[model samples]
Target: MTSLPLVFDAPKRALPPRHLADLDAAGRRAAVAELGLPAYRADQLARHYFGRLTADVDTMTDLPAAARGELAALLPPLVTPVLEQSCDGGATRKTLWRAHDGTRAESVLMGYPDRATVCVSSQAGCGMACPFCATGQGGLQRNLSTAEIVEQVRQAAAAARDGALGEPARLSNVVFMGMGEPLANYPRVIAAVRRITEAVPDGLGISARGVTVSTVGLVPAIDRLADEGLPVTLAVSLHTPDDELRDTLVPVNNRWKVDEVLAAARRYAQATGRRVSIEYALIRDVNDQPWRADLLGTVLRREIGARLVHVNLIPLNPTPGSRWDASPRRVQDEFVRRVQAAGVACTVRDTRGREIAAACGQLAATGA
Candidate 1:
């Protein structure tokens, strides 16, 4: 079993009141017993929340009516929706959530012909200070609680079930590519992942293989996550290949360097036997030069190898008033051609909800 460390690892932040989603089976039973309930009530509560996808205690019919309110204490609402916007004819939806502390975060739910995926936020804002990211510019607010992260998935699953994105379908995947660097808020994010992928009545029960966690190449965290033995996919935001340019682009590259980050990603891939994803946001003429593309391909080909990795090129979703802009389509196409030409797999990411600010931190940065 992947162990969960103490709640919020970041300094001095108050831990949110314990929600059932924050606890393990043993912890849940103890919480229930503290409320003067029987041990069986814990499983019953889990069924309603995880299996039935209902958070309203009144709807948990199997539990005694008298105890419903008491059980409800364990289900304190963690994420409250502020605004929801849909584009692509309602096939893509973005939600802004306000935490109890008034800090805000955002998540995006996108439905495709074959699957539905929700991009969830692990923090209210980011501290990475990546020049192009809205959240990074806004600065870090605080890390979200485990339950706060899990609630976004639960609601998205319910929305998909009710056909929020056209015909009803299972929410097939969850990506930690929303507002925050997921690996920075490591413990609660891992706890939330377990809650998402563990079997029903205990969790949302989505396949571990379907979850992807994105980070700006936090090397130690990458190595630590590799030891957890979970099958979740790892995505390293490597925007550029050379250390000199990456230092200005990713910012965190100054600390870990490009080679160190890629080496850590290689180790993670070897440990899990999964292809690591290298995320490159293609900026117009900034990091989009043909030679840089070639360097990106060569570096990955040497560091991560051909079969062990894939590069996902994001047509840069430029933030408001930012100097950054996405590369031209022709340039983007050529970049992919050059990368693939080096014998490593590369593909352009499908940009959904661009008009509605679907990119990470955009919606929440609106204070919507």
Candidate 2:
């Protein structure tokens, strides 16, 4: 047989210089000073970006006319919207953002009767290497800056306030479940959380309770997050109950076993007094077997009791060329029943954004 060459467009490795939100309060002051502006201007700029959620230099009228232009120039737009595709007639909008380095990521803004939620990406691509995920298939691109992440919320807020979704509304919730494993990008993710929940005239001022961070069970990261003193919900993506399957479904599980991961989650719950979210993706004839569900319920009830856990079952969203598919309705319902039977609260997550490649990595792959 003749030798063959394998080739494809190699993934981009380097991301652009860090955004302002990537820095902490002290770091922001240094950056502002480096820009030749007085230290006080850092707080002023933060007030505009984090508090007022505006990056337009023209609209930051609080600063001196001379300084506003200089400050804005230093902190230029970090995330630019490439496209906003809406499905369900203005109720759901999926936005594709092109970062400064041309790396693309996405976020979904959903408007409901009681709340408006935005699902934000922490990285342009994922490194977890999960076989069925759209983003994981793309490989790791780069971690997003804190400002890049916050800018997504700002844009969503702007859209909500401007009647983008029928009537002027406020962004009520934010979930870090879109692209990369948020805990893997720990530093920047925590910084973004601070910039998000900080008080008025300083940060976005969104309630900590309304923010949720999803991770693939990075144990140490989970424990550290609990100490941050922010009451945001923690969601662990526990696709399978046993280590045998999780080792393949979530590559990180290979490093941290199922028991270790669940223990970490329990510690977080105990420390934070907030119920941890257990996310399980049900695949037909795969992890959705009724026996597996029984085992899962046993693990949850034994490892983390009902008081500290709520299971959210996500039916697999079939990606192009993937062998995976969602479980049949009957199997799905039975799995839920088994878990609930074990006394762990369980419910099926609402499937959305399917019509527009709304899943995290789908839009980037299509655009590429």
Q: Cα RMSDs of all predictions?
A: 2.4, 5.8
- Tens-place lDDT digits, model 1, residues 1-368: 33323332444567677899999889999999999999999999999999888899998888999999999999998788989999999999999998777778899999999999999999888878899888889877788989999999999999999999989989989999998889889888999999999998789999999999999988888988998878999999999999888898888887789999999999999999989999999999889999998999999999989999999999998888999999999999999999999999999999888899888888877766
**Tens-digit per-residue lDDT, 298-319, candidate 2:** 9988898888999999988888
lDDT of each: 0.90, 0.85
Residue-pair clashes, model 2: 0
Worst 10 residues of 1 by lDDT: 1-10
Best by lDDT: 1
Off by over 4 Å in 1: 1-11
